[model samples]
Target: VLDRIYDFERILTRIETGTVSPKDLVALRESLAVIPQLKQVLSGASADLLHSLNDRLQTHDDVYDLLCRGIKDEPGLVIRNGGVIRDGFSPELDEIRSIAANSHAFLQELEEKEREKTGIKMKIGYTKVFGYYFEISHANTKPIPDYYVRKQTLVNAERYITPELKEFEVKVLTSQERMLALEYKLFGDIRRQIQGHIPAMQETARAIARIDCLYSLACAAYDNRYVRPSLNTKATISIKDGRHPIIEKYLKDELFVPNDVTLNHEDHEILVITGPNMAGKSTYMRQVAVLVLMAQAGSFIPAKEGSICPVDRIFTRIGASDDILTGQSTFMMEMKEVSYILKHATSRSLLILDEIGRGTSTFDGMSIARAVIEYCLKHIHALTLFATHYHELIAMADDSPKIKNYTVAVKERGKNIKFLRRIIPGGADRSYGLHVARLAGLPESLLKRADVILEDLEKNGGAPVPAKAPVNPAPSPMGDSLFSSPVIDKLLSVDVSSMTPIEAISFLYNLQKDAKEGSGIQ
Candidate 1:
């Protein structure tokens, strides 16, 4: 519907001024053609807005049919150059074109008509002396028509002319000019006819634009397997197996792990997410904002299931960028945005704050981050997703039921680590900056020196990293520890002691093959 919308505005304006070109006229024809399709697309839609728009849509079938036959498919740009109008549209235009294109045929018909009228079998000829004349042999005894005025006399033949012949000569000579003039008139008449329906067309175009937006949203929903979230006035945002709409598009089906979020007005009001860098902290916060926005905007969200509450406003402080023109540093912009959030944000709002205090010294940044959290808990009390590198923020979860701690799970393989990209209930104290540096192509010697320095700092009580994860911590990946499949589950449940030796062996072999097949290990 919105494919060629770029040309519609100018086309309508030109139609009003009576100067629309044939190329632009084709655009109008295409717009008129979409009316039926629009009606069909919105045929059974239950939305009152869509139904009203459908009602407002006028089917200008006559205008469409006229334009289809009036203009050439591929016409010249300028109307005066001719070839703009198709043949057989206007009888007068077609006749003028015939005269210009078939002058010789007309002359033959003229000679035949004179022969029939006078019975002389006169032949037509032309010369430099006289333009066109009829010749008759003197040997013939038949008398020439008295209406033929003698033009030339010869020994054995005589040439004469008629008023009709002279009239045809003038017409054949000036046919090109007359044809161009008639084509221009026919094009203008068609343009005028279409001009009267400009208001209807403009309304139809607006309808198409509206449909285009909704249709695009629908396409996104269908392509990404997005579900329509149940919207309510309640104070909870619960989603099961939720996904980031953008991140999932480019990632492999199994590679992108889905996480669940449950935020409400009371127990789980503020979620404190702690994770290492490049672990999707910001992505999770943004996903919530985007999903909420989509639900409120009447579009589907990328989640297996969703039930969302409408937020009055969604405030975000996610990325790090400076306003160089305003001479504002990253920290200054961060404070300003947070100030605005605190001032305007209400309890029904959603606040997505990421790394609120990393712009200054440790004490100052931590102090500001803590103060913001306290303000959220006491005064503002918004449904917030606050992400931070300050691990001390996790201690707030113990004191307040409104706060909850979440971390990104990972798998440590000797010196290498893989981000599980799953958010679980806990906190992570170690940022693994050295590991990330090694992954980023840092020199091995520098990594070794940094590790040594980190060890010294930990020993000296500067940055306290635990020797292991806390007791009964969230599940972290281990090395191939009983990878589960249907075959494995069956093997665990089956009573092998009752089976005979050969039967047991056969069952084991079949189970191995099934496991391999299930794992896609062809």
Candidate 2:
């Protein structure tokens, strides 16, 4: 009931805000009513009942009709005729009928009050075998006075349940004490009749519930102006410069700056993105993550075109904060998370780690970052995106075969920096912190001082440079030159392959001494 009411409120909001099309609203209404019909059938009938009646009643609509009539008219008829039944007729039958009739009336009234409180219109339908029931409405009518807005507000404002209403409910129950007792007796018989069909009834209920859930989710997605991504696997995550769905929709005209990112099993296994603060790195990552989640949950994504690899698990280590209560520092928490990923991530997993080592000092962070990249490259093989300010981490791709590096491009026009918000191959040249500081309303003198400090730090190698080379470089003809350079001549001349293991160790020690003493030659 709560879910249905919530869905109805969402639909109403959309209709009022012009976010939902009339056609969609009609479809939503129709879809919303399916579950109630399913519940009615599942609640009242047994599997044998359904099987026996299957040929006679082929459609869900038929079942719905039966429930509506059974609840509304049949029970009353049985109760009214109970007094006139023949001598051989059971008196309990009439008494059961009366209880059912009263219960049905009470339920109907409750449903109406609920609809009024929720601003969801309900259509009551009937049939035989199925008890009386109401649908939470998918009906459309010609515009009536106070039709959309007034009713929506009333729906929003009306209390779902109040103490006064609870009191009235108690009174209703007290007044129907005898009928309730009789109904409880009849409920037992009904349960027995339907016992054999429990599985079928459960299946029917599940199907209806699923339909209801899907419809409600779809309606909510549509109401929030969520764009439906095509359910195909073209390895395309194309949102035409679209904004983050959640952020953009709520903050109109604020411009979410859509981006396109694609990752598949083939060429695009990993994405390494680098950008300045507030340039949408986190937002973009989150956007993709949310889309993947939405898709998996059987929802439409907010993108122009999105084709996703159905990932098994999504691991995110994005934001930074200390657990003061737990007395764990940010770095400790990060390591804890990273350890889990390294241990558990599989080939099908998707990982997004942002500023992974920022919780610690530069050297420590960079070293840990290097080890992590190497580990990911060799073990725990998964599609990963490591976003960081420590550009030195990108160098892992040089030695590791599986790693890749990418940077979010930024445009610098003189003293001004324009965040392009474009992801490209290679690492970032600088963090551009000072430029960001200026943008953050820092004083000109302080900004200049920060720039001077930044330049000095760069000169002294305090800041790491971005990766400009291809992460997955092709094999070079001169690969052997790296090992055979003049610096290692003494080590090479030792001929360790010809020596026994013990002798080889001695030779290596001697070669290391020779090299240290500058006796090694090209």
**Cα lDDT listed for each candidate:** 0.86, 0.59
lDDT of 1 by residue, 1-522 (tens): 456444575788998997788888887778777768768878789998889889888878988899899988888899998998888888877877887788789889988888788888788988867988899989878877778899989999998999988887777677788888888888899988888888887887777677777889999999988999998777999988888988887886556678899899788899999988888888888988999999899899998999999999999987888999999999999999999999999999999999998999877999999999999999998999999999888999999999999999878898888888899999988887787898899999989978887987779777755464478876533323236656568788889889999989999888767766555555
- Across 293-405, the per-residue lDDT of candidate 2 in tens digits comes to 88778787766766666777899887877787989988888899999888888878888888878887889888887777667756766777778787666666676545567
TM-score of 2: 0.51
- Candidate 1, overall lDDT? 0.86
Candidate 1 Cα misplacement greater than 4 A, ranges:
1-24, 30-34, 37-54, 77-82, 107-192, 206-224, 322-344, 357-368, 374-380, 398-400, 456-522
The model with the greatest lDDT is: 1
Clashing pairs in 1: none
Error of 1 at 168 (Å): 7.1
